[model samples]
Target: GAGVSQTPSNKVTEKGKYVELRCDPISGHTALYWYRQSLGQGPEFLIYFQGTGAADDSGLPNDRFFAVRPEGSVSTLKIQRTERGDSAVYLCASSLIGHRGELFFGEGSRLTVL
Candidate 1:
């Protein structure tokens, strides 16, 4: 892929349901990150993975949110016990290791929990 790719551009789920959003980054990029954006706010960092290990996950709101990068090229964000307040655009970005400034973003997967 020439750029980041996110699956299911829009997802609508009922409250208490579980959802998994996937991201496939550009080939060979090593750093991947997940962010969330609400109605009027900018993208908020959720997690970051360096290779197959999570380097930072402090931005995740709570235990219901989790993400994994198993092979270092693709990642999945899992949301458990979803709530109406969790509706937002989940953004995935990637860049070459040590080149955070060159980040590339995917068309976020918009999660609408009703």
Candidate 2:
């Protein structure tokens, strides 16, 4: 893809359900990130992947959230036991390895826990 791509632009589920969000980054980009944005706040970092491994996942709120970039090109965020408080827009961004500040972001997958 020429830019970052995310699937399921809008997802609404009852609380306690499991959800998965996908992100396909720009070709050749070596860094990918997951972020969550609540109603009016800025995107909050959830995880960062460098190639096939996650270099930082400390920002994830709890054990229920996890992410994987198996081949270093596409990533998926998995949420277990979703809660209403988890409703937010999940954003994905990618950039060249050395260019952390220049990220290309996807439109985001909005998850609404009902």
Candidate 3:
């Protein structure tokens, strides 16, 4: 089966603009997660969804950041009023079930807010 996939590998946007990053998980994966990685830092958790419902969303910095996994296979991370500080690589990962299983991550969508 295919691994996770993210679209628009790179994105350049001006401050205050909005952007959407998409991720497609592997077949049969029920656990999906979103993470963000800034320069010189490890990827930080953003959101996690079990099936079609988000189970955890505490990592979202603010209301401006949101995500959805309506079909349990694909997810979209939406950013509103983006700022220069928001520039980073958004990563998506998927797993079969609980944390005990292996997590496969996408190459990541790099967003650069100028």
Query: In candidate 2, which residue pairs clash?
Result: none
lDDT of each: 0.93, 0.94, 0.94
Could you give candidate 3's per-residue lDDT for residues 47-96 as a string of tens digits? 99999999999999999999999988899999999999999999999999
- Tell me each candidate's RMSD, in Å, in order: 1.0, 1.0, 0.9
TM-score of each: 0.96, 0.97, 0.97
lDDT, residue 28, model 3: 95
lDDT of 2 by residue, 1-114 (tens): 778999989999999999999999999999999999998999999999999999999899999999999998999999999999999999999989634469999999999999
How many collisions per candidate? 0, 0, 0
**In candidate 1, residue 40 scores what lDDT?**
98
lDDT of 2: 0.94
Measured on C-alpha atoms, candidate 3 has an lDDT of 0.94
